[model samples]
Target chain A: MATHEEITGSLQAFGEGYQKNKKLKIMNKDWDRVILIKAADVDSQHTLILKNGELTVTEGTPAGDPDLVVTADSETLADLFYGDITPTEPYMNGTLVIKGSEDDIVRLDFISLMIWGE
Target chain B: MKRVVSVSLGSSGRDHKVQVELLGEQFEIERLGMDGDFDRALAKLQELDGQVDAIGLGGIDVYVYAGNKKYAFKDGLKLMETVKKTPVVDGSGLKNTLERETVNYLLRETNYLNKDTRVLMVSAVDRFGMAQAFTTAGCDVTFGDLIFAAGIPYPIKTLEELEEMAGKLLPEMTKLPFHMLYPTGKKQESRDEEKAKKYAQYYRDADVIAGDFHFIKRYLPDNLNGQIIITNTTTAADVEFLRQSGASRLVTTTPVFEGRSFGTNVMEGVLVALLGKPWEEVTPEDYMDLIERLEFKPRIIDMAS
Candidate 1:
C-alpha cells in the first residue's frame, strides 16, 4: 500500500531523474535558457537548464534567464506529471498557471513529454 | 404517499449541489451548520419526525458525539438501537452537499432492486451518498467495497469503459468481475503482468464487488447469474449501452465541477435518471426540469479543497 507520503516521495525522486534527461530532447539551437516548474507542496523552487544533450536541475533560482515559469496547486501538478490531467486542460481550467511566451509554452510541453515519456 | 423518509444534514462530497437539488424537492432536508451542536440538530429533526414520512437519523454524528469524551471512548452502537423505530439511515453530509444535484437525482430516481428487491451496492466511493439516496427512496441496503492497495481512483467518465476494459483483460469466467479486486495500472499500463494476474485471480474468488466503472459482464457468464454491476457514467453512448444491457442500476458520475467539463451536463441527466421514480417512469423532460430547477453556482469554500 503506497501511502500519500510514498506517492510524494516517488514524485520527488522522479522529478530528479526527469531533470537529468531533459536536455537530450532540446538540441534545437534556439532553446538554450532555463525553465522553472514550481509545484505547490515541495516548499522550495526548482531551476532546470536544457541547453546541450545533458540536462541539469538545481535547488535554488536560476542564475541565468529562465525561458518559462509554470505554477499550479500540488494536486493538479502531481496529476499533470502522472498523466491523470492533461497539460492543456489545466491551463484552460485555471488549475495550472503559466507565465511565458507562446513559444516557451510549446517548448515546455515538448520537454514535459520527453521527460515523462508520454 | 410518503414511504420511509430519509434526510441528511446538508450534503457531502464535491457534488453537494446535485445532492441538494435532488433531495430538496422530494424530501425535507435538515441543514446542520459546520459549527452546529449534534443534540440540537437531532431535536430540530425530531420536530418533523411523525409529521413527515419517517425520521432519517442523518449523519452518524447526530447519534454519536465527535469529541465528546463519553461517546467517543465508548461504542455508540446503542444509539442506533435506541432510534430503531424512526427508520433512521446513516446518511453522509459532505458528499450529499458537495455533489447535491446529481446525488439527489439518483436518490429520487434509480431503482436498486428488481422483482427480488435485493439492493446490492457495487461501488463504495460515495456509499453514504448511495445510502442517503436509496434508503430515502425506499429500499433495504447491502453495501461493500473492493479491497485494494493502490486505491481505486474517483469519478471516471463512465462505467461502461470500466466494464469494457476490465472485461477484455480478465475475460475468463473464473475472474468474472474484475472490480472485486484492486484495479491496478489506472493512468498507465502496469509494468508487471504477474502482479496484475495475481489480483485478477483474487477478484475471481471475491463475492462482493465495487468500483467506479463496469467490467463485471466479462466476469459473469449470463444475465440471470445474480450479477449486478453499479457504475457511474457521463457519456450518452454509455448511457444507451447501459439501458441496452439492462443493468440492475446506473448512477450518474458527478465529478467536482469547479470548472467546466463537457460531460457535467450529461452526468447531471444520468443522476436524475437514477434518482427519479423508475427508469421507464421518468422522461427526458423530467430530467431537464430537474436540472433547470436545481441549477446553482457551486459553493466554493476555501478550506474544502
Candidate 2:
C-alpha cells in the first residue's frame, strides 16, 4: 500500500506534468470534467478538475459528483499519477477500473500519454 | 455452385458482388456493409444464417493473435454467434497464411523489400502474421498498435515487445466495444486531419507502410515520399486515394475481382465454402494449399512509379 504522502506527491507530479503539456492543454480546451481517483486499497481519494483547458488536483473528492471515477490499488494509483507506468497497462490488466464514457476514458488516457509519452 | 456472403459493419458504399470460377467450381461472392450498425449486422447475419454457403464477418475481427495465443473480441464473437447454421469467419484463417506469402512474394519477385527496408505496420494484432513476416525477413519493423488503436504515439519496434504487450492488454481490451478499438461504418470513410498531421512523421519515415487499408488511410499524411503500401480490401477509389497521397506503390494481399480486392473475410468465406468444412476444422496449411491451387497472387499496382 502506498502512504498518504506518496499519493500526494504523485498527484502533485501529475499536476506539474499536465501544466507543462501544451499539446494536452490545446486538446482538452473544450473538455471540462471532475475525475475522482479512489485508492481501492487505501482510505484516500483525489479529485482532478479540468476546466478551461487547465487542470488542478485536490487531496479530497469534489463536493458534488465527479464525471468520472477511477479505481485502483493504492500503489497502482500512485504509480499511474507519478508516470511510473501507463494507465493502459493497469487498465488492460483489469487492475485499474474507470467508470465513465468511452470518450472520457480515452481523453484521460491521452492525458497520460501527452504527459509521459508511451 | 457455392455462395459466400460477407456481412460487414463498414460503409455500404463498398458493398460488391462478383462471380468467379475457382478450381473448376463456380462461386458467387457478395459483400454487404451495414454502415456500422451492430444490430443491422447481427440481423443480416441471422438472415443469412443457413442461406449462404459461408459467411464472412467483415469490418470486425473475431480473433487477434500474439505469439501462439489468439484472443477473441467479445463484440466479434457476439456478432458471429448470431448466425447458427452458417460457418462464419473473420478472415483470420487466410490472413495468417496469405499475408505471409505476400511478404515472401515481395521479397522474392520485387526489389521493393529487402533486409534494410523500414516498415511501419499501422496495427499488428489484427494481422500478426504480416507483422511476423516483416520481422522474419530481417526488415526493421515498427508495430503501431498503440499509435493507431489507442491514439498513443508509441512505436513498438520488435515482435517480442508486441507479444508481451498483447499478452498484457488484449484480454481486457477485447472486452471493450469494437467500434472504440477500430473504425467501422462511416468512420472508415473519414479521416481526421489533426491526427493525420500528428502521425505524419511515422508515415514519412517508413519505406513501407502495411496493414489494414482503413488503418493505413485513417491517419495518412499528405505526402508519402515514395513509400510502398501493403494491404487488402481496397476499391479502385482507394487506389486513387493512395496515388494522390504520393504513395509509390500499392499491394493487396488478396486477388482483385471486379476491380476491387475483397477483404480476407470474403476470400476466407470462399475457401470455407470450397472446403465444405467447419471453420474450426480449417488450418493454415489448408489455406495455403487452396491458395496455390487457385494460383492466388497479390495485386501489385504502381501508383506513382
lDDT of all the models against the reference? 0.38, 0.89
lDDT of 2 by residue, B1-305 (tens): 88999999999999999999999999999999999999999898998998989999999999999999999999999998898999999999899999999999999999989996999999998999999889999999999997888766678899987887677567666767788878899989999687899899999999999998999988998888989999999999999999999998999999999899999999999999998888889989899899999999998999856
The RMSD of every model to the true structure, in order and in angstroms, is 19.8, 6.1
Task: Kindly list the per-residue Cα lDDT of model 1 for residues A22-58, writing each as its tens digit.
Answer: 3333333345667676765656456767664345656
lDDT of 1 by residue, B1-305 (tens): 23333232222221122222343443222222212133444454455444533333332322211111111101122233344333333322223333334445533454333232344443333334443454454444343222121122121223333233223222121111111132311211122243334334333332222233423322222222222344432234444443454443334333323221212223333333334453235454565455465563332212111
The candidate that wins on TM-score is 2
Candidate 2, overall lDDT? 0.89
Q: Model 1 residue B254 lDDT?
A: 39
TM-score of each: 0.25, 0.81
Error of 2 at B123 (Å): 0.5
What does DockQ come to for candidate 2?
0.14
Please tell me the TM-score of chain B in candidate 2 relative to the true structure's chain B: 0.98
Q: Model 1, residue A16: what's the lDDT?
A: 65
| Candidate 1 positional error at B44, Å | 46
